[model samples]
Target: MDIFSNLWLGASTAFMPMNLFYGFIGCLLGTAIGVLPGLGPTATIAMLLPITFGLPPESALIMLAGIFYGAQYGGSTTAILINLPGESSSVVTAIDGYQMARNGRAGAALATAALGSFFAGTVATILLAVAAPPLAAVALNFGPAEYFSLMVLGLVASVALASGSLLKAFAMIVFGLILGTVGTDVESGTPRYVFDIPELYDGLNFVAVSMGIFGICEILRNLEGEHERSVGVKRVTGLMLTRQDIKRIIAPVLRGTALGSFLGILPGGGAMLASFASYAMEKRISPNRAEFGKGAIEGVAAPESANNAGAQTSFIPMLTLGIPGNPVMALMVGAMIIQGITPGPNVISDEPALFWGMIVSMWSGNLMLVILNLPLIGLWVKMLTVPYHLLFPAIIGFCCIGAYSINNSVFDVFVMAGFSVIGFALSKMRFEPAPLLLGFILGPMLEENLRRAMLISQGDPSIFVRSPLSLSLLIFAVVVLALVLSPSISRKREEAFTE
Candidate 1:
């Protein structure tokens, strides 16, 4: 009953003319970013963060939230149309989606992706509304020790989730953590790793590093093979799915939604995990599993739906626990903090309108994305015809602008360029950047909580095991780590890598 009343209030708030307009604008911009290679919701939102300062908190958040999830909708368009993935989550989609396009089933692929995403998003949003409160209550009991253990678990899970060698992933994570320490120490007021650069005192800007690594590095990679690239052009025959397509997709979409909704609530789970897990699940369960990488409709439907559902439900952890599951969610947390809104359990009880309003806006935004993306599919496909020479320069320009705008520092531009080179080098070495980014984002928080726990225990490390919750979390982390490093698990991991 109370949930219904809160939802009604949320509907009322979200339906306001101003909020609705912002939601539409957000969806539009998000789709544009997603369609364009190298520009993601995180970069887009970071660029627009300053503009949101003038708007009311609810309206600002609604629009920002819209952009986050709407990107998932637009990302699949590029994945299907071209072999290029607009987002990391769309990588799996591109495997079968591009195959479908090559097989002259682009229309069917697009339709399945759109319809599956809509269905999954709707179900996930409902699950979020129902599950967030209980999750928040659980989080409210976390002391410093528990939080430290949770952070360790998150970091370990993230490293295990990386696509490459576990040792390489751990190395990248350690590098990121070391890089995260290059600023003024919060407790001692001592500067470390600054090397006497004034800008270094503030640490590396997340925007600069993220944009440099993702955006600029992508541009450089694309440019290297520009001459060899053939623009994937396919005739648009139809846009609607056939009855057979629908029959094949319904089960995958439902399964994806269930999997994504649950996984997305975990501390380190987000769209990428959702998509990857969905693909693995579909392959295991599908009758025609061998067809998975060969334009299977289930392949297009399952991961597409799962990524969207995960994107929507990821907000639950960010909003209710003040713990971001990914860099994109971390940026949302930054935006919330900028608006003077502290995200935690009390947010629901204290700021019901903001909480519920954001929830309602997610559904509204999903509806808007479906409507907007259907017609814009042709336009997005046409964008692929734009030459790489022209697009690469524009992308670099945006990367520079985004980095500079983060702190209004020209130094950030230099930082971006430096990281771009480093990212390219890392890519050449076969190291994945995503886990490193995750480590950089979580490292400081983990350290802070660990230090606080130690202080509370008067430097007694045994305090970590004294608390039951903390002990359990630590045990889980250790067990997972042990399993990941075991000989049997290593053999399977090597097989996956070889594949």
Candidate 2:
């Protein structure tokens, strides 16, 4: 089959010494951050994005992908050990996992999390390989009108699924779009909002902006409420699972993988949402539901599987249509642009090795995580004892160096600092920053496509409606908005998020 040959090609590239090393490094750093409660993958990746500009596309992306999913593995460790979830997706894991630990089944709970995540990640990677080509093929048919409509659909879906007030999400999106307009106009070759600054001509550097908002801003928030955690976990043993334990986890793992794979393709639906949804579903339908909050192994298996699967499959839309489903993926899109490779359908045909290589690297990365994480559990636990006051300064220093390296200019450092204040202010106002990042990333593309469609139609807006595909996409966006607005669905959404 064509898939076999493609995978063989991917394997060759993924197995290279340098790529493997980077993947290992990424997994290591991801686990370290995941063990530290305040640092999420989004901030970690944004902080490291500028450094990747020098790497080969395959190596850089493979490493980033490893960091993303490896966090899922690491988060479960702290959840089971200390009742503190290293990542948001692991929040539900902490409930039952800590209970299991308290009951002295810490090793079993951890093994379940590790094994479940590996199985889910493997299945999701296979699904990605089988699914991405066709999706990219379909996307290849999109013209400017269709592309514009698709972007609208993505933005609308993002808003519909974003946590917090819809009005605030909408406002952030508009503000991001406005920020995207700061650079020179592509068509007219005129500066719009440069304010006569030479560095502003290229607009705000995405890496700087992202680092400011995610990396530095997170540090600021964490410092405000900083407190040292005292970890007192007992030594873990009994790593092997019984036959009954295996049987109990089988169905939950399968269900979690399926649900996560599907939801991961949706805009704004990533590991955090998938894990929560899966845990909720299992609590309702699981045969051992009565034991849910009292150290249920099913609770450990299902959500860990779902979160890992969701993390992997969330790459679908990003790789196929060049549309990022979440903030992490948006940062990835920015990375691709920095590497001089456009993220889109053409990637498959134009750069098969890089694309397939990244795909294959994910499977290898999963294997590495399983091998690396189990033995490193003690090391990770030790890492958690490092106080925030000691760790945060190093992070801040790295961010500053990365920002300045963008153009070898001090201006970017200033930009990052400025945006950190803005991001902090936005956080104080309770506005979610995910949609804003998505809007900033998609804004220019949306504007370009809209203008091209208008040019083709000689300014006739009917061009969008004349194409059935475009019309359908627009209609779907409207329906999504309508569904989110309905009272019953709104109540359900609130409940789902609250849980």
Candidate 3:
């Protein structure tokens, strides 16, 4: 009964005139960014963070969250049409989606991606509404020691799950941590690595680094090829799905939603991992595994659905526990903090409207994405035809705008360009970017909590082991590290790392 009442309240908040408009705008913007290569939800939201200063916290969050999942819907369009993934999560979609486009089944693939995402997103939102409160309650019991250990476990899990050489991932993580330390020291109030630049006082902006690495680097890479201007010529027609398509997709969608929901709860398990994992699982379990990588409808459905589910449920940790599961979620936490809304267990009880409003907005945003993406499929496909030369310049222009918008500082633009060079070098060296992102996002929190724990324990390091929960978490981290470094895993890791 309480849940029903909360749902009603949430719906009412979501349906309000102003909030509805914001949700629509967010969905539209998210789709646009998603269709365009380089500009992802993370960079987009960070760019818009300043603009949300005047809006209500709930409305701001609704729009930001919309952009996050709406990208999932729009990303598949590019993946299917051009074999280019607009978002990292959509990379797996390209495997089957592009194959379908090549096979003259672009329409079916688009329809499946859109419908599967909508179904999964809707189900995941409901699950989030039901599951978040209990999880938040459990989180309230955690102390500084537990938090520190949990972060250790998260970092270990991220490294384990990443698709590359463990050593490379570890190196990238260490690099990110070092980058994260460029600003003033939080505890000592002393400068560390600023090198005397006025802008360096605040540290390396997340927006600048992310935009440079993702947006600018993508443009530079795309410009190196002559065929960049040639757009995909695949034709799409019809919206109706065949009965066989429906039969093949239903089971995959269900399985994908389950997998995505679970993974989404883990730190670093963002939409990209969910989508790729879903595709891999579907291929491994399906009797027609031979059809995978060859335009299988199940391949499109499972990953598309899982990506959306993961996008939605990833909010669980951010909203309920104040622990961001990914960089984008960390930005959302920053937004919440800016609004004076501390995200934690009390958020649900003390601010039900905010919590429920955000939940309802997710459903609204998902619906908007479906409605917007279906008819616009042809238009998005047409965009793929834009010459790479012209498109790359436009992407570069937007990257500059996105970087400057974060803090309205030109310094960020330079930072982005710097990171672009670094990212390109790293790519050349075969280092995975995702693990680095995870490290950049977690490093500060890890250090902050570690310091706090030590302070509380009067410099006694044994405090970590004194708490059974923390001790167990540390043990788990060590085990995961061992497994990732094992010889059996090293061979497989080499193959993934080669890309």
Candidate 4:
């Protein structure tokens, strides 16, 4: 009943004409980016953050949330049509989806993806509504010591789950933390790394930093391998699934939704991980296992469902605990900060209309994707035909403009350009940028909480251990790190990423 009331409040806000318009625009942009290969939701959002400054917080967040999930719907289009995954999570979708297109079952593959994603998104949204309140309630009880421990667990879990070398991930996290220390010290007005520059006193703008690292850096990388992709698909038909096709996909969709929901709650676990894991699981146990890479509908169904479910559930920790599970969520945290709203447990109580409205808006956004995508398939396919050489220049120009708009200063633009160079160098070294972004976002919070806990204990180091909740969190983080280092688990982790 309370949930229903909250949802009613949300409906009043989400269904407002202005909010619906914003959500539609967000879905439209999200689909466009998802259909275009070199563009992604993270970079798109980072570039657009400054533009949302004048909008109400609820409208801004709802629009951003729409983009995140809408991309899941749009990414499948390229996977099935051209065999080029528009987003990383769609990589598995291409395996069977492209084969289906080659076999002239492209329409069936696309339909399965749409239906599976819709079901999964709905389930995950409901799960978020039910689970978030209790989690926030638990978080509300946390003190400085517990909050610090929770952050420690988040950073460690991010490292354990990140793909590639553990040492590199640690190095990136440390580097990000170092970058975070550049601003004026909050407790003492002394500047740590400002170097006499006035702009450095306030710290680097995250919007500019993210724009350079993700948006500009991506443009640079794409330029090195720039080439036009031919659209192999001309026309599609037979979108309605047969009874036999429906029967085969039911179990796989259910399994994927459950698996993705669980994994999404873990730090560093998101759509890409869920899609790969679900596809692998279906391959082992699906009755149509032999048909996995041969245009099997089950293959298309499971990964699509898992990815959408994972995308939705990944918001849980970000909204409830102020811990971002991935780079996209980190950007969302940045958006909230830009809106002058603190993200965490108190958000639900202090801003019920905004919180509930955003949740309700996700469902509406998913519906808009389904209603809009099928009819707009032709437009999306045509977008893929646009050349990268022409596309990259426009993107770089927009990123530069966006960076300069942050504070109406050219310094931020320079920061963005400098970070782009740094990001490119890191990519060349095979270091994952995700951990670095997470570390940068969490570093100051971690430092603040640690200092507060120390002050409360009068500088006694044993205060962290004295709190049972804090001790448990620390123990859990250590165990996770230990498991990641263990030989068998390490091998499995590598295999998961490689596959």
The global C-alpha lDDT for each of the candidates, from Candidate 1 onward, is: 0.80, 0.90, 0.82, 0.90
* Model 2 Cα shift for residue 242 (angstroms): 1.7
**Candidate 1 C-alpha error for residue 333, in Å:** 2.9
Tens-digit lDDT track of model 3 for 432-495: 6656666776677778888999999999999999999899989999987887688887665454
Alpha-carbon RMSD of each model: 3.0, 1.0, 3.0, 1.0
> Which lDDT tens digits does candidate 4 get at residues 1-499?
9999998998899999999999998888888888988999899998888888889998898888888888888898999999999999999999999999999998889889988988998899899999999999999999999999998898889889878888999898888878887899898878989999999998878888888889999998888987778999988878888999999999999999999888888899889889989999999999889998999999999999999999999999999999999999999998998888888899999999998898888888988888877766778878888888887788888988888888999999999999999999999999888888888888788888999999999999788889999999999999999999999999988887777
Worst 10 residues of 2 by lDDT: 226-235
Best by lDDT: 2
- Which of the predicted structures, 2 or 4, would earn the higher lDDT when compared with the native? 2
lDDT: the better of candidates 1 and 2 = 2
Question: Model 2, which residues run further than 4 Å from truth?
Answer: none
Residue 79 lDDT in candidate 1: 88
Please give the distance, in angstroms, between residue 214's alpha carbon in candidate 3 and its true position after superposition.
2.4
Can you give the TM-score per candidate against the true fold?
0.89, 0.99, 0.89, 0.98
Give the Cα-based TM-score of candidate 1 against the true structure. Answer: 0.89
Q: What is the lDDT of residue 128 in candidate 2?
A: 95
Off by over 4 Å in 4: none
Q: Supply the global lDDT for candidate 2.
A: 0.90
Q: Which ten residues in a row have the lowest lDDT in candidate 3?
A: 490-499
